[model samples]
Target: MEQPVHHFSELFEQLGLASDAEAIEAFIQRHAPLPESVALHEASFWSPSQAELLRNALEDDADWAEVVDHLDASLRKP
Candidate 1:
């Protein structure tokens, strides 16, 4: 079975970011579309811990993997 869809709030919380609506909107406006050349883990916007979380999620294909992958694709330019 497919996993339930994960919300951006969950992602923000996992990254230790503010998950309030205002914060989420501001974060999206500021960083939603990261450059094509910038890997998710390399984005300066993330804290070191957040970056490490992303890296580990991607590498390990853990429960967070699907959301992390969605984030990776969403952030990058097509």
Candidate 2:
């Protein structure tokens, strides 16, 4: 079964980020609400492997998809 995402911090951990409360909040402050024109995979903040993980999760609709998608949207500029 797929795990429900409980917090942005969890998403950060899955994405290989720091995942601590301060780190997660800092990351969000820095990167959340990405511009509409910027594709998630093309974000400058991600390493190639990290981008690949997100791309694969989204393409496969795997267990990570929900959280990945949440991150994708969160990173977009409103």
The model with the greatest lDDT is 1
For each candidate in turn, the TM-score is: 0.77, 0.77
RMSD of each: 2.6, 2.3
- Residue-by-residue lDDT tens digits, candidate 1, 1-78: 776677767988999889888887677677878887788999998889999999998898777888888777767633
Per-residue CA lDDT of model 2 for 38-69, tens digit only, reads 78878898999888888888899767787777
In lDDT terms, how accurate is model 2?
0.77
Candidate 1, residue 40: lDDT: 90
Q: What TM-score does candidate 1 get on C-alpha atoms?
A: 0.77
Q: State in Å the error of residue 47, model 1.
A: 1.4
Scored by CA lDDT, what does every candidate get?
A: 0.82, 0.77
